[model samples]
Target: MELTKEQLAFFDTFGFIKLSGLLKADITWITEEFEAVFPMLEEKHDGSKRTMIVPFADQREKLCSLVDDPRIAGIAKSLLGDDFNYMGSDGNYYTGDTGWHRDGENRARRHVKIALYLDALDGSSGALRVIPGSHRLDDKFGVDVKRVSQSQTALHVAGPDVPAVALDVVPGDVLVFDHNLFHASFGGSTHRRMFTLNLCERFGEDALDELRAYILLHAHFKREHYYGSAMLRSAGPERRVHLEQVDALCGDYAERTKDLPELPLKALI
Candidate 1:
């Protein structure tokens, strides 16, 4: 449950990293589960008649469970101490516009936010945008509330011209970043846009096993559909995924780090 020197360096400079296919099934389950509840939340429509803002808390625990993945939980433990709380949890939809903003607090103490993508994405497809190295700046520079329709900039920084990562998540991939890093996302491919959040009050362990298994299953499911076959890989010329074994394939991720820091066990949101 430790981060390598490279990962620490990347996080220190870039403010984020893109791990493709990190949590597939968990991603899909959360997305599908939230979409089912999206209609119940207050929907603000845009010019195209699509929901602009649909933040609901009815089933936040379900989505939050996806964030508590042990692997990701491990990352949090490695960076932040093992004493924190799940600050908040909910789902956000951006079929239209999302203003630029930071998820960090304005206080002197530092904090971070981790986002998990539920599907594939690219820069043009309303992918999550981030400002590299911005997390090191002061809280004011780290957080801005100007609220641009598509652009994300804090109070002092120039309009978000920073190199933003596309976050082409393959279902299981998770994006761990500092809240101070400016970020935004918009509509893309008519596909569902979903991600989970793990904001800390201090920092602690996460449910890596449950989280990792969910992601893997999600990716496995998608591959089966895309290739028009089932099986992680077939025994024939065109390898196919055997869907039957997918459910049984969730990895054996027992919580091994008893020494890891302990966070508030309260449910997210």
Candidate 2:
């Protein structure tokens, strides 16, 4: 399941790579599990805006095993390293278009996102679009793309019109990209189904604080821990390697966020 040298090079240079039908054989049960998770949550999508659930795959045992899947783990290990940490996941029902933006500006530790879309999509139907090499924040091309895309008006062009690669995909296709890469989607159905697995290089002693800060951001989802019970319970030694680091550092998350005002459920999106 490991990526080839050329695939690795493509990802390194362009910030993204698409593995068509990587999960095709398993898409049936995968989609079943995906549909089952939404009802287990407190909020539901009504086609008004986006509805998302954090630690998504963690909610179901079958979904939790996705991290243990060789195809997924291999990709993460290839891009970030064997000791990569699982940064949590989100399942979503998206409405309308998403403007260009980077998931995070993670200069210290490289992070990659593995996206699985449940429906067929293309450039005109909300496929993921990425500006190649935009993950290299240190480069001029990366800097210019970020600047212009962030403010569409500066280029006098709409988001969909921006120059980028549109990654069309159907159920089971996998899209992996660096967290710093600029990406967007346009002209999609109201209930486009998708979910993501975020993984990153394990933090060094010097970066533990930064890691803690990042873990704390999960509080916005009202999460007490990054991994749900099913996720932790299903992990064998191999999968445990990805969960342990974050689990060790998130012990006080609930105590730290206990007093924060409760947000409306919709705000969790």
CA-only RMSD, every prediction: 14.2, 1.6
Candidate 2 lDDT tens digits, 203-256: 997888888888887556545776788998888999999999988987887787
Cα displacement (Å) at residue 49, model 1: 7.3
Off by over 4 Å in 1: 42-61, 105-107, 139-163, 186-192, 201-269
Residue-wise C-alpha lDDT for candidate 1, range 1-269, written one tens digit per residue: 55777988898777787655556656656667766655543433233423311122224445434334566656766666443333333344435435456664334334566665555676666667776766765545443322332343333333334445556555667778887666766556444455445444331125444433433432311121211111122223211111222223233311322333222121111
TM-score of each: 0.57, 0.95
Predicted structure 2: clash tally: 0
**CA lDDT, every prediction?**
0.47, 0.87
Each candidate's number of clashing pairs is: 28, 0
